[model samples]
Target: MHATHSSGKGRGHGGGRGFRGAGGWQQADLPPADDAAAWLTGRLPDDWFVGAPTITVDREEIVIIGELAAPEGSDDNSAAAAAQGRIGRFREETREARMQIADEAEARYGRKVAWGASIGETKAIFTHLAVPAMTRLRHDERRVLDTLVDAGVARSRSDALAWCVRLVGEHTDEWLTGLREAMAEVDKLRAEGPDL
Candidate 1:
Protein backbone atom coordinates (compact mmCIF):
# COMPACT_ATOMS: atom_id res chain seq x y z
CA MET A 1 0.00 0.00 0.00
CA HIS A 2 1.15 3.53 -0.71
CA ALA A 3 1.49 5.69 2.35
CA THR A 4 2.63 9.27 2.88
CA HIS A 5 4.91 10.07 5.79
CA SER A 6 7.08 13.01 6.75
CA SER A 7 10.84 12.98 7.38
CA GLY A 8 10.61 14.85 10.66
CA LYS A 9 10.47 18.40 11.90
CA GLY A 10 12.25 20.53 9.29
CA ARG A 11 14.95 22.92 10.37
CA GLY A 12 16.65 25.31 7.96
CA HIS A 13 20.37 25.95 7.95
CA GLY A 14 22.47 28.77 6.55
CA GLY A 15 23.31 28.55 2.87
CA GLY A 16 26.34 29.89 0.98
CA ARG A 17 29.33 28.74 -0.97
CA GLY A 18 32.00 27.25 1.27
CA PHE A 19 35.46 25.75 0.89
CA ARG A 20 36.11 22.00 0.98
CA GLY A 21 38.94 20.29 2.80
CA ALA A 22 41.25 17.50 1.70
CA GLY A 23 39.94 14.02 2.77
CA GLY A 24 37.35 15.69 4.95
CA TRP A 25 34.49 18.13 4.41
CA GLN A 26 33.93 21.34 6.28
CA GLN A 27 30.39 21.87 7.56
CA ALA A 28 30.25 25.21 5.78
CA ASP A 29 30.96 23.56 2.44
CA LEU A 30 28.25 20.93 2.71
CA PRO A 31 25.27 21.36 0.38
CA PRO A 32 21.95 22.20 2.00
CA ALA A 33 19.74 19.07 1.95
CA ASP A 34 16.45 20.80 2.53
CA ASP A 35 14.76 18.46 0.10
CA ALA A 36 16.27 15.26 1.50
CA ALA A 37 12.96 14.02 2.91
CA ALA A 38 11.15 14.53 -0.33
CA TRP A 39 13.97 12.95 -2.27
CA LEU A 40 14.09 9.85 -0.09
CA THR A 41 10.36 9.53 -0.09
CA GLY A 42 10.36 9.54 -3.85
CA ARG A 43 13.38 7.28 -4.22
CA LEU A 44 12.43 4.59 -1.73
CA PRO A 45 10.40 1.60 -2.90
CA ASP A 46 6.69 2.06 -2.22
CA ASP A 47 6.33 -1.33 -0.51
CA TRP A 48 9.33 -0.95 1.78
CA PHE A 49 7.62 0.98 4.53
CA VAL A 50 4.11 1.59 5.77
CA GLY A 51 4.82 5.32 5.54
CA ALA A 52 7.66 7.68 4.66
CA PRO A 53 10.75 7.28 6.80
CA THR A 54 11.70 9.88 9.36
CA ILE A 55 14.95 11.32 8.11
CA THR A 56 17.25 13.11 10.52
CA VAL A 57 20.22 14.99 9.11
CA ASP A 58 23.33 16.41 10.73
CA ARG A 59 26.63 17.61 9.35
CA GLU A 60 28.16 14.14 9.37
CA GLU A 61 25.26 11.73 8.97
CA ILE A 62 21.68 11.20 7.89
CA VAL A 63 19.49 8.65 9.71
CA ILE A 64 16.37 7.22 8.09
CA ILE A 65 13.94 5.43 10.39
CA GLY A 66 10.87 3.73 8.96
CA GLU A 67 7.95 1.87 10.49
CA LEU A 68 6.93 -1.62 9.47
CA ALA A 69 3.66 -3.33 10.12
CA ALA A 70 3.75 -5.72 13.08
CA PRO A 71 3.30 -9.37 12.34
CA GLU A 72 -0.03 -10.93 13.25
CA GLY A 73 -0.55 -13.50 16.06
CA SER A 74 1.98 -11.85 18.34
CA ASP A 75 0.95 -11.54 21.95
CA ASP A 76 2.17 -8.74 24.21
CA ASN A 77 4.88 -10.94 25.69
CA SER A 78 6.12 -12.00 22.24
CA ALA A 79 5.58 -8.70 20.46
CA ALA A 80 9.11 -7.45 20.97
CA ALA A 81 10.59 -10.72 19.73
CA ALA A 82 8.29 -10.77 16.75
CA ALA A 83 9.16 -7.19 15.91
CA GLN A 84 12.85 -7.94 16.26
CA GLY A 85 12.52 -10.87 13.87
CA ARG A 86 10.66 -8.74 11.38
CA ILE A 87 13.28 -5.98 11.67
CA GLY A 88 16.12 -8.48 11.15
CA ARG A 89 14.39 -9.98 8.12
CA PHE A 90 13.83 -6.55 6.65
CA ARG A 91 17.47 -5.63 7.23
CA GLU A 92 18.78 -8.75 5.49
CA GLU A 93 16.33 -8.40 2.64
CA THR A 94 17.02 -4.75 2.09
CA ARG A 95 20.77 -4.64 2.69
CA GLU A 96 21.75 -4.43 -0.98
CA ALA A 97 19.11 -1.90 -1.87
CA ARG A 98 19.86 0.19 1.25
CA MET A 99 23.57 0.28 0.44
CA GLN A 100 22.93 1.42 -3.11
CA ILE A 101 20.63 4.15 -1.82
CA ALA A 102 23.15 5.14 0.82
CA ASP A 103 25.84 5.41 -1.84
CA GLU A 104 23.61 7.71 -3.90
CA ALA A 105 22.57 9.76 -0.86
CA GLU A 106 26.14 10.13 0.42
CA ALA A 107 27.26 11.27 -3.01
CA ARG A 108 24.42 13.75 -3.26
CA TYR A 109 24.50 15.07 0.34
CA GLY A 110 28.15 14.63 1.37
CA ARG A 111 27.07 12.88 4.55
CA LYS A 112 26.88 9.25 5.59
CA VAL A 113 23.46 7.59 5.54
CA ALA A 114 22.16 5.16 8.19
CA TRP A 115 19.08 2.95 8.05
CA GLY A 116 16.72 1.77 10.79
CA ALA A 117 13.39 -0.03 10.99
CA SER A 118 10.71 -0.19 13.64
CA ILE A 119 7.83 -2.63 14.12
CA GLY A 120 5.53 -2.81 17.11
CA GLU A 121 7.62 -1.82 20.15
CA THR A 122 11.00 -2.70 18.69
CA LYS A 123 13.30 -0.49 16.61
CA ALA A 124 16.65 -1.46 15.19
CA ILE A 125 19.26 0.66 13.44
CA PHE A 126 21.00 -1.68 10.99
CA THR A 127 23.86 0.64 10.15
CA HIS A 128 25.06 3.91 11.62
CA LEU A 129 28.07 6.22 11.46
CA ALA A 130 30.05 7.18 14.52
CA VAL A 131 31.77 10.43 13.63
CA PRO A 132 34.06 11.79 16.31
CA ALA A 133 33.17 15.26 17.54
CA MET A 134 36.05 17.33 18.90
CA THR A 135 35.40 19.48 21.90
CA ARG A 136 37.60 21.23 24.46
CA LEU A 137 36.39 21.20 28.02
CA ARG A 138 37.57 23.28 30.95
CA HIS A 139 39.23 21.57 33.93
CA ASP A 140 35.93 21.55 35.82
CA GLU A 141 34.06 20.00 32.92
CA ARG A 142 36.81 17.47 32.36
CA ARG A 143 36.64 16.53 36.02
CA VAL A 144 32.93 15.81 35.71
CA LEU A 145 33.62 13.28 32.97
CA ASP A 146 36.46 11.79 34.96
CA THR A 147 34.18 11.44 37.93
CA LEU A 148 31.66 9.54 35.82
CA VAL A 149 34.40 7.24 34.60
CA ASP A 150 35.66 6.67 38.13
CA ALA A 151 32.14 5.94 39.33
CA GLY A 152 31.77 3.31 36.61
CA VAL A 153 28.94 5.22 35.04
CA ALA A 154 31.00 5.39 31.87
CA ARG A 155 34.01 3.59 30.54
CA SER A 156 35.99 6.72 29.70
CA ARG A 157 35.84 10.49 29.64
CA SER A 158 34.56 10.40 26.07
CA ASP A 159 31.80 7.98 27.01
CA ALA A 160 30.93 10.10 30.04
CA LEU A 161 30.75 13.21 27.90
CA ALA A 162 28.49 11.41 25.43
CA TRP A 163 26.30 10.21 28.26
CA CYS A 164 26.02 13.76 29.58
CA VAL A 165 25.08 15.06 26.16
CA ARG A 166 22.38 12.42 25.74
CA LEU A 167 21.06 13.17 29.18
CA VAL A 168 20.85 16.87 28.41
CA GLY A 169 19.24 16.23 25.07
CA GLU A 170 16.59 13.99 26.59
CA HIS A 171 15.74 16.55 29.26
CA THR A 172 15.88 19.68 27.17
CA ASP A 173 14.15 18.51 24.01
CA GLU A 174 11.53 21.27 24.16
CA TRP A 175 14.15 23.96 24.66
CA LEU A 176 16.25 22.52 21.87
CA THR A 177 13.23 22.46 19.58
CA GLY A 178 12.68 26.16 20.27
CA LEU A 179 16.34 26.88 19.61
CA ARG A 180 16.17 25.03 16.30
CA GLU A 181 13.04 26.92 15.31
CA ALA A 182 14.77 30.22 16.11
CA MET A 183 17.79 29.17 14.10
CA ALA A 184 15.55 28.27 11.16
CA GLU A 185 14.06 31.74 11.34
CA VAL A 186 17.55 33.23 11.32
CA ASP A 187 18.40 31.17 8.24
CA LYS A 188 15.27 32.45 6.56
CA LEU A 189 16.23 36.05 7.34
CA ARG A 190 19.77 35.46 6.15
CA ALA A 191 18.55 33.98 2.90
CA GLU A 192 16.42 37.05 2.31
CA GLY A 193 19.46 39.29 2.60
CA PRO A 194 21.32 40.78 -0.42
CA ASP A 195 23.69 38.60 -2.41
CA LEU A 196 27.27 39.21 -1.40
Candidate 2:
Protein backbone atom coordinates (compact mmCIF):
# COMPACT_ATOMS: atom_id res chain seq x y z
CA MET A 1 0.00 0.00 0.00
CA HIS A 2 3.03 2.27 -0.16
CA ALA A 3 5.60 3.11 -2.80
CA THR A 4 9.19 4.10 -2.22
CA HIS A 5 10.85 4.83 -5.52
CA SER A 6 12.91 1.89 -6.63
CA SER A 7 16.59 2.88 -6.31
CA GLY A 8 17.40 1.54 -9.76
CA LYS A 9 20.73 2.68 -11.14
CA GLY A 10 21.52 5.77 -13.22
CA ARG A 11 20.09 8.56 -11.10
CA GLY A 12 19.25 10.54 -14.21
CA HIS A 13 16.25 12.74 -13.48
CA GLY A 14 14.21 11.05 -10.73
CA GLY A 15 16.90 9.32 -8.75
CA GLY A 16 16.65 8.44 -5.04
CA ARG A 17 13.98 8.07 -2.38
CA GLY A 18 10.52 9.53 -2.70
CA PHE A 19 7.84 8.15 -0.44
CA ARG A 20 4.12 7.66 -1.04
CA GLY A 21 1.41 7.27 1.56
CA ALA A 22 0.03 3.79 2.36
CA GLY A 23 -2.39 4.09 -0.54
CA GLY A 24 0.33 3.71 -3.15
CA TRP A 25 1.28 0.64 -5.13
CA GLN A 26 4.67 -1.05 -5.24
CA GLN A 27 5.32 -4.02 -7.53
CA ALA A 28 7.69 -5.44 -4.98
CA ASP A 29 5.23 -5.34 -2.14
CA LEU A 30 3.46 -8.59 -2.92
CA PRO A 31 1.08 -10.71 -0.88
CA PRO A 32 2.48 -12.89 1.87
CA ALA A 33 3.73 -16.36 0.91
CA ASP A 34 0.45 -17.92 2.03
CA ASP A 35 -1.44 -15.31 0.05
CA ALA A 36 0.38 -16.45 -3.05
CA ALA A 37 -0.68 -20.02 -2.47
CA ALA A 38 -3.58 -19.47 -4.83
CA TRP A 39 -1.06 -18.35 -7.38
CA LEU A 40 -0.78 -22.09 -7.86
CA THR A 41 -4.26 -22.05 -9.38
CA GLY A 42 -3.00 -19.69 -12.05
CA ARG A 43 -2.08 -20.68 -15.59
CA LEU A 44 1.55 -21.73 -15.07
CA PRO A 45 0.64 -24.83 -13.10
CA ASP A 46 1.43 -25.33 -9.42
CA ASP A 47 4.85 -26.93 -9.36
CA TRP A 48 6.15 -24.30 -11.71
CA PHE A 49 5.72 -21.73 -8.95
CA VAL A 50 9.31 -22.53 -7.95
CA GLY A 51 9.56 -22.31 -4.20
CA ALA A 52 5.85 -21.72 -3.91
CA PRO A 53 6.74 -18.93 -1.53
CA THR A 54 5.41 -15.41 -1.43
CA ILE A 55 7.28 -12.80 -3.46
CA THR A 56 8.36 -9.22 -2.74
CA VAL A 57 9.62 -6.75 -5.31
CA ASP A 58 12.50 -4.61 -4.05
CA ARG A 59 16.17 -4.07 -4.65
CA GLU A 60 17.65 -3.55 -8.06
CA GLU A 61 17.02 -7.26 -8.30
CA ILE A 62 15.05 -9.51 -6.01
CA VAL A 63 16.54 -12.90 -5.46
CA ILE A 64 14.43 -16.01 -5.30
CA ILE A 65 17.14 -18.12 -3.83
CA GLY A 66 15.47 -21.46 -3.27
CA GLU A 67 14.44 -24.45 -5.32
CA LEU A 68 12.10 -27.22 -4.39
CA ALA A 69 13.21 -29.76 -1.83
CA ALA A 70 11.56 -32.49 -3.80
CA PRO A 71 12.30 -35.99 -2.63
CA GLU A 72 12.70 -37.10 -6.24
CA GLY A 73 14.99 -34.17 -7.02
CA SER A 74 12.76 -33.28 -10.00
CA ASP A 75 12.32 -29.76 -8.66
CA ASP A 76 15.36 -28.10 -10.20
CA ASN A 77 14.58 -26.65 -13.59
CA SER A 78 14.06 -23.35 -15.40
CA ALA A 79 10.43 -24.04 -16.28
CA ALA A 80 9.22 -23.82 -12.70
CA ALA A 81 11.29 -20.74 -12.04
CA ALA A 82 9.91 -19.06 -15.13
CA ALA A 83 6.33 -19.82 -14.16
CA GLN A 84 6.64 -18.46 -10.64
CA GLY A 85 8.34 -15.34 -11.91
CA ARG A 86 5.77 -14.92 -14.67
CA ILE A 87 2.63 -15.61 -12.67
CA GLY A 88 3.74 -13.79 -9.54
CA ARG A 89 3.65 -10.43 -11.30
CA PHE A 90 -0.07 -10.38 -12.06
CA ARG A 91 -1.85 -7.94 -9.71
CA GLU A 92 -5.49 -8.59 -10.59
CA GLU A 93 -7.87 -10.76 -12.58
CA THR A 94 -7.95 -8.40 -15.55
CA ARG A 95 -4.19 -8.24 -15.79
CA GLU A 96 -3.92 -11.94 -15.16
CA ALA A 97 -6.52 -12.60 -17.85
CA ARG A 98 -4.80 -10.33 -20.33
CA MET A 99 -1.55 -12.02 -19.49
CA GLN A 100 -3.21 -15.33 -20.20
CA ILE A 101 -4.39 -14.13 -23.61
CA ALA A 102 -1.01 -12.70 -24.51
CA ASP A 103 0.68 -15.78 -23.21
CA GLU A 104 -1.48 -18.02 -25.37
CA ALA A 105 -0.88 -15.83 -28.39
CA GLU A 106 2.80 -15.92 -27.68
CA ALA A 107 2.84 -19.61 -27.10
CA ARG A 108 0.87 -20.60 -30.18
CA TYR A 109 2.11 -17.88 -32.50
CA GLY A 110 5.39 -16.95 -30.85
CA ARG A 111 6.95 -19.81 -28.93
CA LYS A 112 10.30 -18.29 -29.75
CA VAL A 113 9.40 -14.91 -28.25
CA ALA A 114 12.39 -14.62 -25.96
CA TRP A 115 12.32 -11.26 -24.22
CA GLY A 116 9.88 -8.53 -23.26
CA ALA A 117 11.33 -6.18 -25.86
CA SER A 118 10.01 -8.26 -28.72
CA ILE A 119 6.56 -8.45 -27.19
CA GLY A 120 6.77 -4.75 -26.43
CA GLU A 121 7.60 -3.94 -30.02
CA THR A 122 4.51 -5.83 -31.13
CA LYS A 123 2.51 -3.81 -28.63
CA ALA A 124 4.00 -0.61 -30.03
CA ILE A 125 2.75 -1.57 -33.49
CA PHE A 126 -0.80 -1.78 -32.19
CA THR A 127 -0.30 1.42 -30.22
CA HIS A 128 0.75 3.46 -33.24
CA LEU A 129 -1.69 1.98 -35.72
CA ALA A 130 -5.44 1.71 -35.76
CA VAL A 131 -5.72 -2.04 -35.58
CA PRO A 132 -8.92 -4.04 -35.85
CA ALA A 133 -10.49 -6.29 -33.26
CA MET A 134 -12.59 -9.39 -33.93
CA THR A 135 -15.66 -7.15 -33.96
CA ARG A 136 -14.30 -5.19 -36.88
CA LEU A 137 -13.93 -8.06 -39.30
CA ARG A 138 -16.67 -9.52 -41.49
CA HIS A 139 -18.15 -12.93 -40.78
CA ASP A 140 -16.20 -14.43 -43.62
CA GLU A 141 -13.04 -12.41 -43.01
CA ARG A 142 -12.82 -13.60 -39.44
CA ARG A 143 -12.12 -16.88 -41.14
CA VAL A 144 -8.72 -15.54 -42.12
CA LEU A 145 -7.43 -15.20 -38.59
CA ASP A 146 -9.17 -18.38 -37.56
CA THR A 147 -7.77 -20.21 -40.52
CA LEU A 148 -4.32 -19.05 -39.56
CA VAL A 149 -4.86 -20.03 -35.96
CA ASP A 150 -6.16 -23.43 -36.96
CA ALA A 151 -3.73 -24.48 -39.68
CA GLY A 152 -0.75 -23.34 -37.65
CA VAL A 153 0.87 -22.76 -41.01
CA ALA A 154 2.39 -19.58 -39.70
CA ARG A 155 4.55 -21.86 -37.53
CA SER A 156 6.17 -19.38 -35.14
CA ARG A 157 4.06 -16.92 -33.16
CA SER A 158 5.50 -13.83 -34.82
CA ASP A 159 4.52 -15.03 -38.26
CA ALA A 160 0.95 -15.56 -37.17
CA LEU A 161 0.85 -12.15 -35.49
CA ALA A 162 2.18 -10.36 -38.55
CA TRP A 163 -0.35 -12.08 -40.76
CA CYS A 164 -3.28 -10.98 -38.63
CA VAL A 165 -1.97 -7.44 -38.44
CA ARG A 166 -1.51 -7.34 -42.16
CA LEU A 167 -5.08 -8.44 -42.63
CA VAL A 168 -6.24 -5.67 -40.32
CA GLY A 169 -4.15 -3.07 -42.12
CA GLU A 170 -5.87 -3.95 -45.38
CA HIS A 171 -9.37 -3.38 -44.03
CA THR A 172 -9.36 -1.11 -41.04
CA ASP A 173 -12.62 0.73 -41.75
CA GLU A 174 -14.50 -2.40 -42.74
CA TRP A 175 -13.71 -3.77 -39.31
CA LEU A 176 -14.64 -0.55 -37.53
CA THR A 177 -18.14 -0.45 -39.01
CA GLY A 178 -19.72 -3.18 -36.92
CA LEU A 179 -17.08 -3.90 -34.35
CA ARG A 180 -19.41 -5.03 -31.61
CA GLU A 181 -21.26 -7.59 -33.71
CA ALA A 182 -18.04 -8.78 -35.25
CA MET A 183 -16.55 -9.29 -31.82
CA ALA A 184 -19.60 -11.19 -30.68
CA GLU A 185 -19.42 -13.45 -33.71
CA VAL A 186 -15.73 -14.04 -33.21
CA ASP A 187 -16.21 -14.73 -29.52
CA LYS A 188 -18.92 -17.22 -30.33
CA LEU A 189 -16.64 -18.93 -32.80
CA ARG A 190 -13.86 -18.91 -30.26
CA ALA A 191 -16.09 -20.53 -27.68
CA GLU A 192 -17.45 -23.06 -30.12
CA GLY A 193 -14.10 -24.06 -31.59
CA PRO A 194 -10.67 -22.96 -32.72
CA ASP A 195 -10.24 -20.99 -35.96
CA LEU A 196 -10.87 -22.83 -39.20
lDDT tens digits, residues 1-196, model 2? 1222365432233544332212223322432222222332343444432444332222121112213322232245554544344333322223444355445533433221111101111111111122232235577765665677779767544456677666775878566546645644654565577533
Q: Could you say which candidate leads in lDDT?
A: 1
TM-score computed on alpha carbons, candidate 2:
0.17
How far residue 59's Cα lies from its native spot in candidate 1, in Å, is 0.6
Error of 2 at 153 (Å): 57
**Where in model 2 is the C-alpha error above 4 Å?**
1-20, 23-44, 49-51, 59-66, 69-196
Per-residue C-alpha lDDT of model 1 across residues 65-182, encoded as one tens digit per residue: 9999889998888899999999999999999999999999999998899999998568989879876778779999999999999999999998998899899999999998887677
Q: TM-scores, in order shown? A: 0.84, 0.17
